[model samples]
Every structure is written in structure tokens, then in C-alpha cells.
Target: MFENLKILRRAVKAVATKDPELRVQRFYLIQEPQVEFLDRSTHYMNVGFWDGDATTLDTAGEALARKLGEAAELRAGDTVLDAGFGYGDQDFLWLREREVGRITGLNITPHHVEAARARAEAEGVTDRLDFQLGSALSTSFEPESFDRVVALESAFHFHPRSAFFREAYRVLRPGGVLAVADIIPIDGATPRMAFKAGPLSFLKFSLPDENWHDGSTYAKELTEAGFADVTVESIREKVYEPWRQYMAGRVDDDEYRRKLGKALHKGVVRHWSGQDVMRQELDLLDYVIAVARKPE
Candidate 1:
């Protein structure tokens, strides 16, 4: 009962707060129930990149991280700065698969920082992966410190994403790359729909108005931030619809029902299956993988 009240209070604060980072932080803090229901195995908080052979939730999330690595042209012996590193899943993937030299992760959420640090220690990769409680918008890293900067499914909450872009440019080496897997409102999403109050009204709190831009504008932002070779490629087809289908299937499963707990299962089935609100909300979003580079 008290926990429910706490979530209610946090939700109200998230809706009312003008600070984008705080709003997003509160949203994530209140999303434990939703997160558990969505991904049962992994700590991946992304809307998975679904494609051939990436059917399950965990595999699809990993595939999304790998896709970002490919976009960044991540190479061995390159140092990486993972901004908004949720659970440090992508950092682990890059260290093991891509053989990146080292990764330093920055995140605003203390819970994520603690959890990721624990995971890093348990996995015996603390030397290569460091998770710190910090903001991507204004990092403390030195200029030209890293070879690559990446944000996986987390840049949208960066208040004004342009600030992070400029910071990325500042902290990256002369020839470093900046890669991002981000979600933004489509060009067709007008002010009304973007700020509409309804099932997905939480988006109004989580996504800043400045971040509601199309691909072209996104590329322009990167260019303005002193990045060259900017490319923002849409991959919405493989992210949203397939994820909705997978969630629909999972909500219908008895095993998932047991796993999600009774209250969350009922709520998810109600809003997700009975009303189809999730699909309606997703239709208005566009997912893109953006790649850019600092000139040598």
C-alpha cells in the first residue's frame, strides 16, 4: 500500500517536474514493475532491435547493442564512453565481443550505477569496465579522452540532446566516433499529438520538447556540435512493431504471467492487450541509429 503511494507520488512529480533529467530519473525509478514484466532474464532496458535470429527479448536487446557497435565502427584497442549505460549490458557486450580496450560508463541513476558496479565486479571485468554515477550532458572526463562515445536507447532523456552532442565532441579524440540508438517523434508528430494527455502522457515528461526532432534535424544537431560524417538512419521497422508483438505473446503466456507477478500481469494485459494502447503509442515513434565522427 505504501509502495503504491510512493509510486503515485513519484509519477506526479515526474509529470510536474520541468527538469528533463529529473523527470526521466523519476520515471525509471518508478518503472521497476514494468521492467520486470518486460524483460525477465536480462537487465536490458531497450526496446529490442528485432530481426532474423533475434526473436527472444534478451537476444534482440543484445542485437540492438551490437548494431550500435557496428554503426560506431567500434574497433579493438579503442577506448569507449558509454553514456546512460543501463545495467552496463552493452559495455559488457563490447568488451567481450568487440574486444574494445576499455569502457567508462556514466549514468544519472544511482541504482543503475550501484547495480552495474556490482555486476562488473561479479563478472571480473572491473578493470576494463567502470560504472560511475554521472551525467552524460556534462561529463567530467578530459577532452579527447575516448575514441568512441555511444548512447544506447538513452539519449532522448538528455534534456536537450544537443548539449550531450557537444559534450561528446569535446571529450572524444580527434578521430573518434559518436554512435547512438535513439527514439524520436516522427516529423508527422505534431505538437498536439506529441504533448497529448492520455495513456502515453508519460512521454511528455520523459521526452523534452527540444528532443522531438526528425532525422534530418538530428543530423543537423550533430553537425552543429562539430561532428562530421553524420548519418541518422531509421530502423523503426525492426524495433517497435516486433516488440509489441513479442510483448503481446509474453502477456498471454502462463509462465510470464507467473513471472510478472499478479498485479503487473493484470495491468499489462489490461493496458496492452485489451486496449492496445501500446501499439497506438509506438506508431508515433521513430527509432534511428545515428553515427558521426570528430575530424582528425
Candidate 2:
């Protein structure tokens, strides 16, 4: 009972916090404790690619990573830049499977960077992985520094994602690939749909500052940023529906609900429940994977 009270207080406080960065920090702080109970081997935060009944959360996540890698044409001995790398799960996968030469992970959250760094060290890949605390919009890396740049489900939070495109183009070597998996307002989605999604969804997902651009807009931005052969593919049915179903199943489980309830009170599980509402009733958004290349 006392623990529940504490959790409720945290949830209230999280809702009250107006600053975006502080809210993000509070949200993750609530999530940290729950990580131990989750599948720690692949701490993926993205919506996974579910092919069929054979897909588990980990495998789905790996499939998404593979999709991004294929889009980027990732190869051994390539230096990759991972923008907004959540927990560096995909980085570990890439290291193990793709045999990438090196990875520089940039994330706005400090704890995520620290946790990812620790995981890399534990996996004996610290020499090949570097985690930095920073934003994707503006990075400090030198020009033409990376062979590939990728953001897995994180670009949506980049305020005006166009800036990140230009920055990626600046940092990537000629002929380097830029790949992203992101969420956007569905093509031709009406204003009413956005309104129905509600403010909580927007705040929780950090979608407001993103300008909610669709796939075509993203492709145009990449092209304007000097990327050639830009392609944006909507995989909403494959990603959003399956992901929503998976999350709904998890939330339906008694044990998971109990844990989530506690986490919600503590503000660690903000906006998760709201996702179901968005998925079921709103249908205002789509999941897309985009790829482009810098010309030589």
C-alpha cells in the first residue's frame, strides 16, 4: 500500500514536470528498476518487426535491426554512427552479426549512455564501441567521419528532424548511408486524428517538436540535405499493429499489469497505457524506415 502511494506520487510529479528534458529524465528513472525484470539481453525500445507467430520480442527487435542494416548496406570494417541509440541493443547485435568495425553511439540521455557503455564493456566490445552523451540534431563529430549513420526509432524525438538529416550528411563520408526507423503522422491523416490522439500522447512521445512530418517530407528533407536515392517506406501494418498487439498482450498479463501499475505511480511507465488508445482508436501515425546515400 505504501509502495503504491509512492508510485502514485511519482506519476503525478512526472505529469507536472513541464520541461521536456527533465520529464524524459524522470520517465527513464522510473523505467530503470523495471529493466532487471525485462529481457536484459536485448533491451530494445523500438517497435519490433513481427513476421508471424514465430516472432518473439527479441527476434522481432533483431529483425528490425537487420532491416536497418540492410538499408544501410552495413559491412565489416565500416565505422557507424548510431544516433539516439537506446541502451545500445542494436549496436551489440550489429557487432555480433554484421561484424562492424566500430560504432559511436550518441544519445541525449546520460544514464542510457552509461548503461550502454557498461554493457559494451561486459560483452568485451568496449574497444569497438564508444557511447557519448549528446543530441542528434547537433553533434561534435568531424565531417565525413562515419561510413554509415542510423537511428532506430529515435529520430521522431529529434525536434525538426531535418536538422539531423543535414548533420548526418555532414558527418557521413561520401557514399555513406543514412538509415532510420521512425514514426510519423500517417499520410493524409486529418487534424481530427491528431486531436483525438490527445496531448498526453504527444507529450509522452515527444512528437510535437518533431513537426509530425510524413514519409514524403522526410524523403524530401534527406534529398535537400544532399542525400541521393532517398527512399521512405511505410511499414505501419508490419510494425505498429504487431507492436500494439504485443504490448496489449503484455499489459493484459496480471503480473505485468501489477508491475506496470507500480511503475506508473512512480512515473517510470508514463504514457504506455495511452499507447493502446492511440493504436486502437486514433490511427493517426505510421512507422517508416528510410534510407539514403551521400554521393561520392
TM-score of 2: 0.84
Model 2, position 45: C-alpha lDDT score: 75
Query: For model 2, which pairs clash?
Result: 7-265, 7-266, 8-265, 30-268
TM-score, structure 1 vs. true: 0.92
The whole-model lDDT of each prediction reads: 0.84, 0.76
**TM-score of every candidate relative to the true structure:** 0.92, 0.84
Candidate 1 lDDT tens digits, 1-296: 45445656777887787776777778877756454536556778898999897888898999999999999888998999999998888899999999999999999888889999999999999999999998999987899999999999999888789999999999999999999999887873556244442345666668777888888899999999999998999999999888877877887899777866777666656545543656766777789999999999
Clashes of 1: 0
RMSD of each: 2.3, 3.6
In model 1, which residue pairs have backbone atoms overlapping below 3 Å? none
